[model samples]
Target: MLDRRRLLGLAAALTLGACATGPSIHADYDRSVDFSSFHTFSLASDTPQPGAPPLTWQRVSDAINRTLQARGFTRSDTPDFAVGFTLGKRDRIETWNYGPYYAGWGQWGGGPWGPSQTQVRTITEGTLTIDVFDAKTRRPVWSGTATQRLSGPVSQAEIDAAVTSVLAKFPPGSTQ
Candidate 1:
């Protein structure tokens, strides 16, 4: 039997679950370093994943460039920091089942009454990771990651938005 408290708890859980969203963002950096000292940046000469379309690289570079430039950072041959990024995807399977089945008591004692339904779904999750390294130290100074469910082809707007969100905390500590 479902009591009043149990019913209320179930309703709250369902409501919260329904409101859940994907495409989370996270960032971290070395606290000991002074971000303001870094003024210029240049893209690293790392090769894109084999077989990746050239357009994808172009889009990412353009998006990062736009964000950094907007933040008053200049791109130069000899920069204080270097920027690089990686993209990846993975498969995930999710399944859900309908409510419990109720047995109906008739002349035949007890039998299955309510229909039971179940469903399984496959989802592809995409991740974008950006790394910033100090050119002199050749070590990572800052990094950010964004994860989200992927559907169909990725759009330029989506890429731009994700990059912007990840870089929103750029330069860490000090407000700039």
Candidate 2:
């Protein structure tokens, strides 16, 4: 027996789950290079999208630095690899149509076949791409990217989560 409260809760949970999807993460590295040989890294540069907030960019940089350091990679003026990143965002509109059966029972006086209901929401999607370049060769050795929906103002925790997800498979082989 599905009571009103339970049914409503289930509906809300499903809706939220559909709206908040996990970040899409992708990473690749050059197999010819010896990843273990690289022990030091330095921030080379960052290209944030036009009109992007500087504070958000800083948070991302800080998160990447922390993640790399935790993985036993040291920061140095003369590094074996130089790290760079780019940030981008775009607006997206999502529409969901619950055809003829939303909130079918209650004081609202709708039967099992209620009128169609549609939901439209505007959201911001953000993408972060990190690149690692061989300092000597000045060529890209590794790259990772993460794309996800941004809810409200960006926070350090959010940035950390995204960075962590993106870099989860760095250095070609070692599991971290």
Candidate 3:
């Protein structure tokens, strides 16, 4: 019973709702490593993509700093772990094709189908990867990634939320 305008509006609302939830966060760590032993961390010399926007690294670093501090970690010159991140983006294209599979016509067929239709959308997806390396081994012990569709300029709170969501899995264990 929905008209074309109504259907389009509903789709837009659903897309916006998905965007509001921000990015999807994922984390992975060496199960053999004891995260409890990690008490102090230092910002690694690693930098974001050299061509990245000037403030992207600053914002990401600040957000990571705040999140780690809140999780009972300290910053030190000679640290247990080195924290770093990488930023990247890519264009994603999604296409949806409906109909042509059934014997149906546009409207009035008494069937719930329409004419063969196709919708193609391109979304810019941004990825942020946070890595934690053992200072002594200089190898990664944990990594978290956040991926989301980028629509416009991002805000600090959004950055913080993305960082927080990823690191929430830190010190991964049954107890945590």
Candidate 4:
């Protein structure tokens, strides 16, 4: 029974460690407009929010650009729509665990034994936002964001993934 608890604890730790500041922004797009026309990009706002130290910005932009290029977008002087984004994270701590103790299967009421420690975890948090705008009109058009708990130091790879996941939703044509 103790072995099971240890296994459960270890699995939970792996999940926590693998987790970033928030859920990955899955790139979903409106199949209305054609994405090929998209050219040129611009910053919506230079405003920066207080986020996970600095791992925030690099994570968002790099991911967006990479995703766009992968889908066949080129950096041009003039383009279809304007792109603007902001990155930030916040220090979030909850009374939630921060630590977990497993008493084993038998220890829990579920098992055929005694009581077990309640499973809980306090998660730190962070958020990222990307705002897209109409280039010709210079008005905000589409935007996407992602927020997650701050488990630990975020690497460039994770940031890129989060950004990629979110921007994948960028509207191309627009049926809606």
Q: What is the C-alpha RMSD of each candidate to the true structure, in Å?
A: 13.5, 12.0, 9.9, 11.2
Q: Against the true structure, what is each candidate's TM-score?
A: 0.76, 0.71, 0.79, 0.57
Q: What lDDT, from 0 to 1, does candidate 1 have?
A: 0.73
Which TM-score value belongs to model 2?
Answer: 0.71
- After the best TM-score superposition of candidate 2, give how far the Cα of residue 25 lies from its true spot, in angstroms: 1.0
Instruction: Sort all candidates by lDDT, best to worst.
Output: 2, 3, 1, 4
Off by over 4 Å in 1: 1-22, 102-115, 174-176
* Residue-by-residue lDDT tens digits, candidate 4, 63-117: 6767777766675567677666654444444443222334344455454343343
Residue-pair clashes per candidate: 0, 0, 0, 23
Instruction: Please provide, for model 3 over 1-176, each residue's C-alpha lDDT reduced to its tens digit, 9 standing for 90 to 100.
Output: 34754443332222212255578888899888888899999899645445554466677788889899888899899999999887766667999888564546455646566467789999867777889999999988999888887666677777778888788878686233
- Relative to the true structure, how large is the alpha-carbon lDDT of every model? 0.73, 0.74, 0.74, 0.53
Q: Rank the candidates by TM-score, best first.
A: 3, 1, 2, 4
Pairs that collide in candidate 2 are none
Error of 3 at 114 (Å): 4.8
Output the worst ten-in-a-row residue range by lDDT, candidate 4: 9-18
Better of 1 and 2 by lDDT: 2
Looking at candidate 1, the ten consecutive residues that score lowest on lDDT are 11-20
